[model samples]
Target: MSRRHVPAVLALVAGALVAVPAQAAHAATVQVPCSVPDLVKAINTANGTPRADTIRLARGCTYKLRAPDPVNPGNGLPVITSEITIDGRGATIERDGQGGEVPRFRIIYVDKTGVLKLIRTTIRGGYATDCPAFPDAVGASCGGGISNNGKMRITHSKFTGNTSASPVFAQGGGIDSPGSAKSTISDTEVSGNHVVYTGQEPESGAAGGGISNDGPLTITDSKLSGNTATVTPDTRSTAFGAGIISFFGTTIKNTVISGNRAFAEKGTARAAVSNGIPADSGRLTVIGGAVRDNVSDAPGGVAQGGGIANNALMTVKGVKISGNRAVAKDGIARGGGVRVGPSGTLDLKESRITGNTVEAPGGTAQGAGIDNPDGGVLRAERNEILRNTATAENGTAQGGGLYHAAGLPASGTSTLKRNTITDNRAADGGGIFRASGGLTLNGDVVRENRPNNCAPTGTVPGCTG
Candidate 1:
């Protein structure tokens, strides 16, 4: 009787072992349902898994994150802490409230140990304000939609209607990366995002209306448009990079930056895309892109760099800079298309700089096309500069096409080679203006500018008025 019982129990145990091994040998793809609770559970499981996981969201479904996570108060979803890839499959994940709005939390947050890959999703209406746990700005909040302190990869996605809502300091309305983050974005759309400050606090401003990265970032074949960085009230700070801003090691290739704005109600406004502010040592390289229809307006303060502004090293090649404007009502407006700071070096080649304007009806405006304000080194080669305008009502407008100001201690240098500067209009120096700097021209065509070509009749050598 005992021998028979032993054999029966052993047979049952052997069956259980074989069944467990069969199931563990082949894992199925984890797919989350359209329900919010299911999605939350799926992400929680993925974060706890040791191996990298890919979770496919319900097709074309909208996952509404109605409330912040209980563990992390500022995040709408679970904090990603492992290698996870969320394949949206045309679905959308948004922070849901009153139109996904008003003091909202972020959609996704990646911790330092996490790696996130987002594909084919749309992240909408995420707002980050007073987020102390964020890696950058500490208490000031950063990254309305997605924030990464680890690594992130985004492809074929969209980030829209997000805001980083601190007036004191903030960064990245659409996406943000702190100093420890590394990201690669490809074929994405980041639009209609904002970083706005309306308080009258002195030096209250923010950076990067669409996306901001303080670490290594590479963006390719993407579109960044309709983003804004606006600072209202009587503040004296500066709002920088309405489209995108990076501190260091950023490269943008084959992207489009258009219809972005930097508006300062009382402070200074920078351009659509900023490599780095003057205080940083960031470097940017832009290739085969278009920067167009951007604006920098500061009626009560200065406006600099309507399109692309650089205070660090920048290399731009095969790009188009067009239809950008810099406006200052009672102050100075400089650089309608591009502005290079004194510590900056710009190497622009084979680009088209056209139809840019510096409009200061009640102030002074300078450099309709490109302005390198005397401490920067600029080299323009084989480019077309055409039909730009520099106009000022209170002061004389100068440099319709390109402006090189007086040299500083660093002594800025300008070299124009095989460039065609034509059809530009200004009060003085319609073609190219060299107030004082090292100017070397070789095979450049400076002609047909309105008012005159080269102000003071002899400022630019090898050019006749």
Candidate 2:
């Protein structure tokens, strides 16, 4: 789950599953008991089992997992090779690797593409020192969680209070999905998982506080709360997605992303601190959920969809984005809710985007809600865009509610239809700023969303405003 070879294995398995001709075989269920209260032995037995197998863990048992082998040569910890399914029966697999070595290991690692399923289990990624200098890297950071590289399906599972470092870094403190792994996580609760990237100079590397998805991934109908992705600037890296970081093509639907934070000041003196879905390539879609009460020094800067520096295409439908703040004392910033690059596109449909803010108290430029640079595009339909503010008075200019700078083409090309745009304030377009590029509107309620434009601050001809 930590390295990239697991995904390769999954690809091989999926290919084998699809290509290999086989007669219909009855499903084989293997019982791997942690009856001795030894979670590590149970895991080792399950992992050592052959492929096309199912491991059913006993119910009502409490497993104290042992420390992983310290001499794992490649990457962090050993890899789970078999195409196996591990099922926990109302059991708790806790990380019991007490204070010994500086490094630690993950709880469940699904390596191949075969179905790896879990039911009614609590996986606790115990606690460990996740500093950059630690021997183990992000994937193998201590804890009782799972690193999934293939098809990982979880139902009725709980993840609690997994800590990477004292402060937390970009470790998969709770659940880590590396790449090209398809996951179905239903009825799962992930809480209090912190990637404490506390090092002498924390800014050197970035960490995934709760969940880090680097490839094509999908998470549906889950709860992620109270997770922290904190990094020290001295480490010279980015700390983001205190709750979740989705790179590559990722889709999260019918889930809640709340109370997560990326605190960069505690570690070192890094320039930017990011949280919640740091920028990367691919398609990210968030539908039917809320992204609220999450914070970062620069939360989702220069990107769209959700949170920091995203370069992928972000599409949000039937979602609520409220009380999310993007803060940076530096002079330059954009897209408080989303800082989209010049080429990225942000499309929101039937979504309520309210109470989000972009503030640059120290430097100059900033945009409150959506900052579409010269080539960027922001399209909203059948939604309420309200009460968002951008507060940069001294030479801080552009669309306060939404800035369509000369860099990002005209809003004339962007579509704002059947939307209630009101009560938003800023230096430029207080309600919405169509600075240079024009925005198009159709059947939109241009209520009180006001901007400080030069001409009539009313609806401009091009912005259907």
Candidate 3:
């Protein structure tokens, strides 16, 4: 335990340090040059390395791929299999294939072992062709921009001009995160994305024009607009969420979903945002966002759930759902603002649903503002549902502000408190309509509609014209 032993210990420590690989000591920072091949090589090197790496891309460069990557077939870059963060200095990574026909392959694919953090990048012109069965390869031929099965955090980015097309079904025109992925997207713009599916079932058909999150995901301070989800299913099913669809527990905070369209051969299901599935329960919490100017069109079926659709346990707080439309060319039009499905339960508070509309060219137009017609429940408090309209070109209109078909076929409850339902227009039940269900209204004002308020006056107690 003296100076002689100190020299021996120091020698042993130096030998051990020499045995450790340089990459294992700490994460490396890789700088990619201003060229396509260089970017690909950098990604490949970082992915092949044995540690987390930060790849700093060339500033203001456009690394466009000329062909498919050999490492990851049908992709623009190597498959991500390691923890890597691409610090893009206002750059773009896209595919520039033959004739620029929206390159058939996607831009990025993150494997299950990967953890990708992409920042300050723009991804565009990614076109994903379809597959007959999804949830198979995260539906390999989907998610035009990025197909993520691992952890991903994307911030300060843009995804535009991406597309998903299929003869049967497709999803995630811009991005798809599935299979137990941990994803967070913030300060992003996801617009001009499109999905088209011509299948027989809308439930598995065109969905999530902007982003699809079947995993646990959190999106904040993002804008999703001008996304289209079109489904031509032969039969009846739900094509949900033209702007965004989540089938798992999701949180969307301070995000704006506007100008998205959902069109179906049968029905649009929902235009702006759709949450959850019917067989299994899900949860979605939307706080302080705007869902505006979204459209749900169905020439073959009904126009339902124009602004927001929920089949999960959803909670909407301090949000605005206005200027949305539900158009039906041959069937009925309902739920111009928000629709709660048979298995859904909505807890909407401190929100506004105004200036929404429903139009049926040959059928009835009902529930111009909000509709809870099935077994689902609606507990809306401290909200406003006003200035909505229901118009029928050849039939009748009803339920201008709110419609609660409580016990027609299924039994549910509608408990409304501290809400305003006024200045809506319809042929009947201009403010509120209750075909049947256990309805409890307290601290609400229903007035100044086109017709008298609350049809079948005796059906609702303590309310009369």
Best by lDDT: 1
TM of each candidate vs. truth: 0.91, 0.76, 0.90
Best by the TM-score measure = 1
Instruction: Write model 3 residue lDDT over 109-129, tens digit each, in one string.
Output: 777677889999999877775
Task: Locate the minimum summed-lDDT window of 10 residues in model 3.
Answer: 7-16
In angstroms, the error of model 3 at 263 is 1.1
Candidate 2: global Cα-lDDT? 0.57
Q: Please report how far candidate 1 places residue 296 from its true position, in Å.
A: 0.6
Q: lDDT per model, in order?
A: 0.81, 0.57, 0.78
Candidate order (TM-score): 1, 3, 2
| TM-score computed on alpha carbons, candidate 3 | 0.90
- Please give the lDDT score at residue 53 for candidate 2: 57
Which residue pairs collide in model 1, if any? Answer: none
Which regions in candidate 1 have their CA more than 4 angstroms from the true location? 1-28, 99-103, 130-138, 179-181, 277-282
The reply for model 3, stretches above 4 Å from the true place, is 1-25, 97-103, 130-140, 199-204, 233-238, 267-269, 278-282, 407-409
| lDDT accuracy of residue 305 in candidate 1 | 90
Query: What tens digits encode model 1's per-residue C-alpha lDDT throughout 296-318?
Result: 99996888899988777889999
Sorted by lDDT, highest first, which candidate order results? 1, 3, 2
